[model samples]
Target: MTSSFLQGKKGLVIGIANDQSIAYGCAKAFRQQGAELAVTYLNEKARPHVQPLAEELGAEIFAPCNVSHPGELEGVFEAIEARWGKLDFLLHSIAFCPMDDLHGRVVDSSAEGFKTAMDVSCHSFIRMAKLAEPLMAEGGSLLAVSYYGAEKVVSHYNVMGPVKAALETTGRYLAAELGPQQIRVNILSPGPIMTRAASGIGHFDELMHHAEEHTPVRHLADINDVGHAAAFLASDAARSISATTFYIDGGYHAISG
Candidate 1:
């Protein structure tokens, strides 16, 4: 049954590269809850894959938004402003690490590679918050994806781990700054899901197996698990929840042995 918790609300979904993406899952949930959406693809190559999903979600504004690309992020906001004049929520799920840096020890990771990873994975979310602030005059929810590796040393997680830690910190600070305006910022740290982005991490199959065995649920959290939580955060139901990390890991983080 279609829900109305988000009825008459508008949201922007960034970082969906394909149907399997976490962003896609969130967008699907948002639409099911009756929220109007604006979705963006990273670039031309990503457009073909993401466009159909946007259409499926009935996104009214679909644009290209590779934050690394100059003006692209702003263009997406402009499109939203033109169509909806405001936003109720935003999701940021994109991250990156040069393969060499990602596979190497964090200590050996080059300064330039570290900078690039921080820029794309951590800083991009900050940029989006800046753009979304004005459009969220009525206040809004801003969500980003992080991981267990941010808080613990997952073997082979490498440079991206530190980058994710930064992301979590960034979210908290943004939440504190934006709270007075009623704009909530929160982070979702999902357990291993085999999205295209997750494929970059080394020994990912092993990580999945480990997560499956260790989690209290004895399985990984699927995209739907994430989608539902995101919907709640974006809704008024979670109005008091902000500046926190929701670990969608099926109790894996709870395991001690």
Candidate 2:
């Protein structure tokens, strides 16, 4: 069931750490739908894990984009400009908080940890958006990943919850700001699944089981599910869609108890 819905589109994907990463899943889907891709790895340590996936995706440009690193993000965009001259879409799927801060109460999180979380998980997207803006001269989509905890209280999702909330709000503002340029921005919030990042969360198994049990569909979304949504939103088919959040959770977010 491969489709050409995304044929001729060119996109950049950031935050792919390994095969199980949501970024990998979405990038896979985009390739399946016939889009050209440029993918980023975090660093040399992450390069081995991510480069193989980038090869599989047939990415035309593979570069490093450690947003925290002084000039890495800019270098990535510079590579994109040299290689493709333009970008049709961009995906920001990275988030982080030190495990200590993540497992502790939000109020107890150190100022440094909070700032780090916000800078990486939230502010990074803003930076990405700014870098991706001029490259998207033809009006394109910008997307990022989110979680239910951003809007509600989810155990073990402390600092990231607020960080993700900031990300969602940032998406809206970027959408409004970039809409005039025909650049669309949106957020995708998925239920718990065992991502490498998720494994860092305290009581994550309990969280996953609880989500599956309480979810009306009696299951949780895998990376593929989120990927398909990302594919749809990134396509020309979703041209009119922007500045919104799509929950990929299986009815769990709607449950009362």
Candidate 3:
């Protein structure tokens, strides 16, 4: 059932590429709970896919944001500042790595590829937190997507494992840094699910099946599951929670096969 858990809240959602994106799931759930939204598309090529989804969610601010671009990321926040004046939450759900580095072992990955992966997948969250902080004057939540690979060695998760590890640690530190202001920073780690981003991982199908089979629940979660968890974290319900990794992996992270 729909509830007004986030009624009157205003936030931004970055990293939605298409309908199957985790950011889309979060935006959908947040809207169902009555949160006003601002969304971003990567570029012109992605605009067609994301704009419709933003329209469907009634997002008041829809703009192009490529974090790698000089001012694109800043521009989105600037628009949010102009439109909303204040912010309640923000979700960062984008990650990228070149195919070669992703398919290669961490030891063999090139310096440039590793650096680019870290910059996009991990450091971008830090940049978002910095940009989102001032707008969250009334105290708000900041969330980023993480994975079990951050904590353990999952086959085919090579370079990203370390990248996510950095992200998780970054969230912890941000949580502590922002807590005094009543701003919360957290990471949401979900089990293997086929996302446009995940398509780059080598042997992804094998990874997904292994997760389902070994997971205590014997199943995996979908985008909606991650979305709901994200909504809860963004809501007043989790006011005291900060600097933590909230897992929506259906017992997969707890078991060993």
**What C-alpha lDDT do the candidate models reach, one value each?**
0.93, 0.92, 0.93
Clashing pairs in 1: none
Question: Can you write out model 3's per-residue Cα lDDT over 1-257, one digit (the tens) per residue?
Answer: 35599999998999899989999989999999999999999999999999999999999999998888889999999999999898999999999898999999999999999999999999989998899889988899999999999999988999999999999999999999999989999999999989999988889999999889998888899999999999999999999989999999999989986
User: By lDDT, is 2 or 3 better?
Assistant: 3
User: How do all the candidates rank in terms of lDDT, highest first?
Assistant: 1, 3, 2
User: Candidate 1's residue-wise lDDT over 129-234, tens digit each?
Assistant: 9999999998999999999999999999999999999999999999999999999999998899999999888899999998999999888998888999999999
Where does candidate 3 stray beyond 4 Å? 1-3
Total backbone clashes of candidate 1, pairs 3 or more residues apart or in separate chains? 0
Off by over 4 Å in 2: 1-3
Tell me model 3's lDDT, rounded to 2 decimals.
0.93
Worst 10 residues of 3 by lDDT: 1-10
| RMSD in order of candidates | 1.0, 1.2, 1.2
On residues 84-156, what C-alpha lDDT tens digit does candidate 2 reach at each position? 8899998999988987899999999999999999999989999989999999999999999999999998888
| TM-scores for candidates 1 onward, in order | 0.98, 0.98, 0.98
